[model samples]
Target: MYRVWNFVTNYSLLLICGALIALVWANIDAHSYHQVVEYPLAFNNWVGVDAGYWLKKYGADYGVTEVSTLKVLSFHYLVNDVLMAFFFAIAAKEVWEAVVLRDGALRGRKAATPLFATVGGMVGPISVYLGLAYFLGSETYDAVVRGWAIPTATDIAFSYLVGRLVFGAGHPAVRFLLLLAIADDAAGLIILAIFYPSGELAPEWLLLSVGAAVAIYVLFNRLPQRLDRGKQDRPNSTWVRKKLSFWPYLIAGALSWYGFQESGIHPALGLLPIVLTIPHADRSFGIFAEAEQHLTDLLNHIEHILKHPVEIVLFFFGLLNAGVEFSSIGSPTWLVLAGLLIGKPFGVLLFGWFAAHPMRLGLPQDMRTVDLFVVGCVSAIGFTVSLFIASVAFDSSTMLGDIPVQDAAKMGALFSFAAAILSVIAGKVTRVQKQNG
Candidate 1:
């Protein structure tokens, strides 16, 4: 019973269940689903005006007047923009730890192999998407070109889950996939920040965001030292110090999020900059290395506290965004499917082979080319981040005629389940071949 409970509550299982429930609920009664998602959670109308007046005053400045109003917060906004900020923060921390920490995938000269594989993973999908778009002629090309990054994402939970099922626990291939996914996530964040802006650039807000991130870094590093210097012997001193240490980062993250939003960039991108600013522990200690004198590393602390919350956030994120009408599938659907299913594996294999040979990077000793190929297939499952990009790439208000395109993209994201099945089959085949040999 305990094992069953553990399995059910596991992060990947929870995400899958959430996505499944959303699909069933949406299909059973899409009207209610839409109504619930679109329902407004109104804030105080302090100025005592309708939504339109606020839109007219501040909306044009941001170029989102047609899409949003300040009068209320919809459930979609709550999940995607606000709640998902923490999700992105977690992702940012993982990326930072991997690249900057001593025990990370990029820590040593040979350890950097996965980084190159990540580049191939991203490049393969994007190149395939663009090539397909070009061959499909001008109209199809224009419609699908904006979503070139959609197939490049690897849903960490889903891909890891499938990889584990195929390769078993503690396999080197699984570790490779995890590192590749982390790199893919970093790339996805960069694409989101560069390609998806809400409106006209607000340079002033961008500057403020950068300044806020810098200040948070200074405070995160210095706060514990200042506290320890004064009161080491006090009762509950450790607890008090821990509690106080967290607030500056919390406040700073919120400030930076707002600044990014005001800057016309997606606020989730704000977490990336803030994450980079956090002090990393020495590489000698390990990935979750503690700070000197028992001071908590801010990045590790944030990840620990927010781990469960981020899982919950992912559930709500899937529930709010994963609902898709199957009947609405079209070109965008096929394009995304082709890019992820075909492009992802090809890129990973081609680039991975090159990196191992010409680049003189090392692959895990036990991992065969077949194992790498299976991992490549597993990496094709692009769900969460892909859906987020689809939402951003095809706005209904801006492209009323292209509403179907957005829905098709959603359908493609849902098709990642097929990729998971393929990975399992590939894994079984490899296992059989090994046994026969």
Candidate 2:
């Protein structure tokens, strides 16, 4: 419980604070809030939103009549597209370790049930969100259909925190929830990369990203170990670690980021390739485990160094992305909320039961079948990633009647906090027995 709370305070509290501040500011003075958010930090053709798009969207507010010689690097773009890459890089690191490490949580038979449940968690939300939109009419459905992935997100930090509260620290469901959340994040990244493009696709430019990954891995990682083979001192690997450190990877990541931006992929995912190339310990201590801080592997070292910066990035991300006005709450908002609150529990429960029963996979000892629903309820707190997906899923210019689709969708993401309270109630209604460690 202490560890869970500690993790939340370390990573999520500032995000929540920024979100709350944005909500209040947006409601009170929307124009000013938006002005600050869209304020141009730089004007360069190499980065940020295109000049024509910026002019068309916001030039009137800024009183700019002509296209600038350079593009606009708004404060919003700096935070969401560039700086937030660090946050997602950290996420990718955890996912990479979970899948690649020998003792990874996502490995082997133990993960089967949770993985199945994760699929359901995603499918259920997409079905509910899109299905309900279809009923709302063609205009509404077309406006919000792209945001189907929003409710599939499960914020790992908040979910872990709530899981501890609902089922206690010792319950197997807590661990199961963590696994599901991690898997969901992994899937979300893939969905974002595939389904959501930051711009027009250019497959050739992805070569730069792939090339960077391969080059860095071979030159810095593989070469060092190969040279150190059969040597007790491991001189080459040690020299690379002591002297070069993470600089090479940073350079490679920057190149990859540029590649992604140019390739019309979200730049926030740029660091993902670099994460895989970094050398890591063979074993694992799990996400947010205290023991992980002691690991000297470059991967862990990078994550440790990134911790503070990523927190700040997340704070800014929340501040910039979560400033939807109260009036923005409409059908999309309800659809997002319904997908999360209703779809998640049933999806996890039904699929989890199937896996544990007919599929012949079994739950962890002492973890009841009903606990899967509780885990789903806990996983439905899709505050952070949900907000992110919503931001990318729709443009601010998009409207369904009077309501801005992006803002309405974001409102739904913000409202997902309600899942926390609902989870507690579900635990009680289902007669959950808390198992304190």
Candidate 3:
């Protein structure tokens, strides 16, 4: 319990603090807030939004006439695009370990039921978000259809926290919720890469990212292990670990990030390929496992080094991306809420039942079928990743009637905290038995 609270304080408490400050600041003085969020840190052709586009969109408001420049790297871009890559890399490491390692949570038949439920979790939100838009009218559907993936996100940290509160720390449902959230994150990454490209697609540039991963894995990682195969002391591997350290992978990660930026995929996912190339321990202890802190592998060491820096990045992430005004609460807000609150529970229950009974995949011991619905309720607290999806799904210029669709959608994401209350109520209504490990 102490470890769980420590993880939340280190990662999520700062983010919530930043978000609350932004909400207050945005409502009080929107103009000043916008000015700070868009403040340009640099103007160069190599990265960031095009300078011509920025000037054309905001110059009249800022009383500027400059248009012939390279690009504008705003404060928002620095946190969301460049720094957030480390956040996603951490997520990818967890997912990679879950899939690749023996005895991993996501491997073998033990994961089948939860994996099926994960699919339903995503499908339910898309159906509700799109189906409601269709009923609103063809024009409404056309405007909001792009954001179908927004509600599918499940913020792993917040959901896990809420799950522990609702079901005791020893309950199997908590582990189920973790598995579903991790799989949902994996699916969300694929959705972003395929559907919401940052710019025009260029296939040739991806070769650079792939080449960097392959080169580093073969030259530094694979060669060192191969050279020390029969040697008990393993001097070559020791020298690489001691003398060179993480420099090789860091250099390769930079090249991969540039490749993703030029290739039009979101640069925040650029570190994923490099994450796979890092050396890891042979076994797994699950995410947020207290036992994990003692591991001496390079991957875990890198994750430990990043813990504080990523917390700071998440703070700026909330400050920049969560500044929607109260007036922005409109149809899209309700639509997103409905998708999360209404669709997710039913979707999880129905599919989870099918897998447990018909498909012969069983639930964890002492976990009743009703617990699936409560798990869904906890999973619907999609604060962090849902807010991120809303940002990339619709540009600020997009309008649905008189509302800014991006801001409205963001308000919906922010409101997802209500699901935490809903989850507690559901647990009480369902008469969940607490089990302390």
Candidate 4:
């Protein structure tokens, strides 16, 4: 009973619940859902705070002669654009840590297979998506060509959860899947930063963002050295140094986030540069060995503090983004479904096989080919990041318009639930195989 209670209260379960609530609310009373999401919260409008009044006042600032209002972001925008930035920041930190930290997943030759598999996973789904779209004729091809990156994402939490259920605790394949997912996340962040933008590129702002990241890196590296040089042998010196060190990173992160926003790139990428800039200890001791060292590392501290907050962010993220109007589902939805369901596993397996043979790097001793295949199936659960890309891919008013394309993308993202079922069945088969062996 206690275990069941713990499981239900887990972050994965919370995310699932949030998504389910959004789905039910949107389907049952879409008008109410829309109204709630669209409800205006005025910021710097200089008006009576009414949506209409704020719009007119906002428009005047831009020298528009027309009686148009400024673009006021809805509650949904606040959650996705604002809150999700922190989520991405933490995610970036995790990916950076995995690569640079001692005993990290990406540290040695052992990681080669999974790294290759990650690339394969990404390339495979996108190839399938584009091929399917092209074969569907011009209209479908044109509509979904930009959405190739959507199904390439792997929801770390959902995949991890399904992995635990299927493979039980402490499976090598599960760990491998996690490493692949982290790499996939890094790739996804790059794709979002490079591919999705709201307006013309502002290179100056991008420079500022990079500059801020460099500044943070410099400060992080130099501060401890300077402090040690002073050599104050006080009992609380460690605590003081740790506390003081965090402010620079906070300021730097804020600056970069604002810069990315101004630079017409997704602000979530702001953290990626900063994350890479943070120094990590040699992973000689192993991946989990840095627990003690994390106390002094600002990047690790920031990630730890964000662990709980990210859950809240994910909930609101789902509430805002997962409200798919199922009735509006169409052909584009199949593109997403096929890309994730079929393309994901095929790509993973194809790449894994190549890595094992021609590449001369074999799979982990404890893991079988079937285990890798099941991991690929688990990777098919492309939830959070996939939905985010879907939103970005279909957001253009000039090219693809919004509602229909966005809705179809959402339907495909929501269909990741099917992957959960596949994980369970595959997990059972693997468990039985393990017992028989």
Q: What's the lDDT for all of these models?
A: 0.73, 0.92, 0.90, 0.72
Stretch of 10 with least lDDT, candidate 4: 284-293
Best by lDDT: 2
Ranking by TM-score: 2, 3, 4, 1
lDDT of 2 by residue, 361-402 (tens): 999999999999989999999999999999999999999999
Cα lDDT for residue 295, model 4?
58
Residue 246 lDDT (model 2): 97
Candidate 3 whole-model C-alpha lDDT, 0 to 1: 0.90
lDDT of 1 by residue, 1-437 (tens): 23223333544556667778888888899877877775555544321223574455444444444534344455677778777898888778777777876667656765577778788888888888889878988887887788898999998766776776777655778778877887888889888998898556786888777888888766655554565575767434355346665676677777888778778788767666777776555543322223322436555666667768878887887888778777667777888988898888888888888888787786886777667678778999988899889888885433323446777887898796688888878778878232210
lDDT value, candidate 4, whole model: 0.72
Assess the local accuracy of residue 182 in candidate 3 as a C-alpha lDDT between 0 and 100. 91
Q: Worst 10-residue stretch by lDDT in candidate 1? A: 284-293
Model 3 C-alpha lDDT per residue in residues 1-437, reported as the tens digit of each score:
88888888988898988888899999999999988888878878887877887888766666768855677887888898899999999999999999999778899998999999998888888889999999999988998899999989998998998999999999999999999999999998899889988889996899999999999999888999999999999898888887888889999999998899889999889988999999898988999798889998889989999999999999999999899889988989999998898778878888888999899899999999999999989989888889999999998999998899999999999999999999999999999997878
Best by TM-score: 2
The true-versus-predicted C-alpha distance at residue 281 of model 4, in Å, is 5.6
RMSD of each: 5.5, 0.9, 1.1, 4.9
- Per-model TM against the reference: 0.83, 0.99, 0.98, 0.85
Q: Give the lDDT of residue 348 in candidate 1.
A: 85
